[model samples]
Target: MKNVLFIAVFLCSSFLRAQEGTNMKRVIVPPEIVKLAFEKEYPGKTPVWSEEYVGDDNDEIRYEAKYDVNKTTKALAIYDNLGNLKAYEMQISLSQLPPKAQSYLKKNYPAKAIKEIAVVVDDKNKTTYEVGIEKDSRFYDVVFDKNGGFDVIIEKN
Candidate 1:
């Protein structure tokens, strides 16, 4: 169930008529609106930004910002053209993941190394964690609910 939205959003974000690719170009200063919004929402935090123009027209551009929320937590925030905060992804340590998610990993992929644990925050602030790991030269992303319930598994060749 969650896989559908995850795949759909990823597909929509990856492809757009105006963009040949979803390359993230680093910018010293983001758009004025994006700067203002980020400042207002997250004061005192330094931000590094990257932007990609999505969709088919001028109105469809999107701006993304990456910054360190703490020494151990990295944040990736996406803003709309108007600078409205759309969503953000937070990278957390394996120990920070839900207990069930951790246990599942230990039992199922004990021999494989755990990579990254990322929490996706949607517009309404709903969150999901995606754990990235590689095995046998193939990468897999396993997502879980906040309570550590299994969600979806995606393989990358």
Candidate 2:
């Protein structure tokens, strides 16, 4: 099967990683568990792969599977190093968001234009919308509940 071949290749790559240790640079090919999870959840979708390292020293790495949900929406799911699903984000527009989310953004950030809108679905499938705004050379990801309640703001430099 194709999955089998994929897993074999992944294992080979991982063995190389284990031998070389963490100092290895360049993009990592994810283990089989990640591909299996992606297949089970999004059967018909083909994901374009990418990943990033988190933590102060970049000690932790997460894999991403990005795909399109529809003509207008682009979606991506994040997986932990062991291939557990963490969250999903869908790029959307204010008009595509739930009414409550749209209203909340309008009321709170009245003067600021939303640079990007994303619907974030956690592992439990709980959905939240994040509105992004760029101001003062910083990017802000403002989280809002489905009903448009304020959640939190994550500022990135």
Candidate 3:
């Protein structure tokens, strides 16, 4: 079960990353509704938007907005075609992570410098933590549950 979940998350993140790469070459304007929703929800913020197609036929569309919450904090918001928020993530300091998560990283990845840490909230309001680490020029996301228990590690391909 754990493996399955890990694979699923990996595939989804990979797809999004792939889509992002593709988007960089060509500008894709988001739907008006999506833009309006974002404006209403986060007034006075401009974001770089990208689209991701999902579902069996890849007909369902999702938009991702990347922006800075402040000079030091980066944030991302994912919304459906109708503009409903699917998930939100924001960068945080290492000290912002749960104590157990910090200890786990210290013990398991000794001497490794963390690249980024984010707190993600899904549509269902479930919270998770993702810690980015690099090894041998490769990047990986080590995810932990709300309570800081180890969840899964997703490697970027």
Candidate 4:
């Protein structure tokens, strides 16, 4: 029928348009450049490095780099594998955290310094933020529910 043929043509055109929109040029960053930047940022701190190769369902490949600044501290840097810095973050403290998060830190980890904070959204569309703390050479990971209430606390000595 003409109606069925028209529907098929419309679906095919839409699919092609969607694919074209998602076709972006691959970005590459060289390892040497990343290394130089890392050194420049951390001056006297030498990095202990490790890397892993990852590929997406779309066949896009990337490299994940991890740098251990010290026995108790680390940094994560992601690249397209050609060495472009896709993302980078340095491990830091609670004082450098946002004001909304500071209140929770002061109340729960009075004597501890928050080393990391991660915000994650689950499949159910619920959002949770996790805070990691360090106290007396021990690490603690605490998760706060969507409402900012304490969910779970994990401690590692």
Candidate 5:
């Protein structure tokens, strides 16, 4: 009787652990969204690679599609399975920033050095580019917003 009770308890514990492991909260992306993004990003070619619901169960549901135009290169796109474009980044050999932005930085901080730069595009189609510079043992964060048509510059003292 003692041995039987111990075995039953062990089985119950194992079953509970298994259930907990399987209960992962994950976002569900519809198939239509994936199809639309793929079509928009790649017009003539079919997707060479596709993945649905990547990442852990607790992570957001994202669909990734890749297409290859040549043997050594490929293009990649990531979209929410529900058709929302989260973010897409591509590497380029050259920088294609505006001349005005370059002149502004050069004129204002001639002695300063650029530390980092980042561009963020929100869901509402708004774009913000941030430029970080370091000068005289201080850090500056400059932000340029596309929709607002304004520049916000902050200096850490």
Candidate 6:
């Protein structure tokens, strides 16, 4: 469900536009309203920014903010052009996973080293945990419900 968002809002508060024809991406400078919104929401923190198109016509853009939440935790917060928070993802330690999730990983993916662990909270406030691991050189994302029940698995290559 790759719903994680938030990262790319401040490294350069400039707009990036893809050149119409060739394979090159053009970097253009423009007023970034999203950066203003982000600053208001998260004062004292500068974030890296990226733009994404959403909606039926792909005409809407969302801004994502990526930054370190703490010395050990990396976090992302996604927002709409209007500054509405769309989702959040935060890195966490394995011990933070629910006990059932921990057991499931140990039993089903024994001896496999975990690559990443994170928790995602959507605009609706629904939460889920995502665990990344590698097997046979293929990376996978295992998603679990907030309570530790299995949700789904996605092959991420």
Clashes of each: 0, 0, 0, 3, 0, 10
Highest lDDT scorer:
3
- For model 1, residues 1-157, the per-residue Cα lDDT tens digits are 4443464234222222113233435575677998999999889998767666545353356677777789866777778778988767777788888999989988888544566667777676667778877687765778788798888777743
Q: Which portions of model 2 show Cα errors greater than 4 Å?
A: 1-28, 55-58, 110-112
| lDDT over C-alpha atoms for residue 32 of model 5 | 80
Candidates' TM-scores? 0.75, 0.69, 0.81, 0.38, 0.38, 0.73
Badly placed stretches (over 4 Å) of model 3 are 1-26
Query: How much does each candidate deviate from the true structure in C-alpha RMSD?
Result: 5.6, 11.1, 3.9, 16.6, 17.9, 7.4
Ranked by lDDT from best down, the candidates are: 3, 1, 6, 2, 4, 5
| Span of 10 residues, lowest total lDDT, candidate 4 | 8-17
Model 1 gets an lDDT of: 0.68
Best by TM-score: 3
Global lDDT scores for all candidate models: 0.68, 0.64, 0.72, 0.48, 0.47, 0.64
Clashing pairs in 4: 29-82, 29-83, 29-84
| Residue-by-residue lDDT tens digits, candidate 2, 76-107 | 77787778887777777788777877777777
Candidate 1 error regions (>4 Å): 1-28, 53-59
Rank all candidate structures by their TM-score, best first, as comma-separated numbers.
3, 1, 6, 2, 4, 5
Clash pairs, candidate 6, are: 6-65, 6-77, 7-64, 7-65, 7-66, 8-48, 8-49, 8-50, 9-48, 9-49
Q: For candidate 5, list the clashing residue pairs, or say none.
A: none
lDDT-better candidate, 1 vs 4: 1
Q: After superposition, how far is residue 115 of candidate 2 from its true place, in Å?
A: 1.3
Q: Mind sharing the TM-score for model 1?
A: 0.75
* Quality of model 5 by C-alpha lDDT: 0.47
When summed lDDT is taken over every stretch of 10 residues in candidate 2, the lowest stretch is 8-17
Question: In lDDT terms, how accurate is model 3?
Answer: 0.72
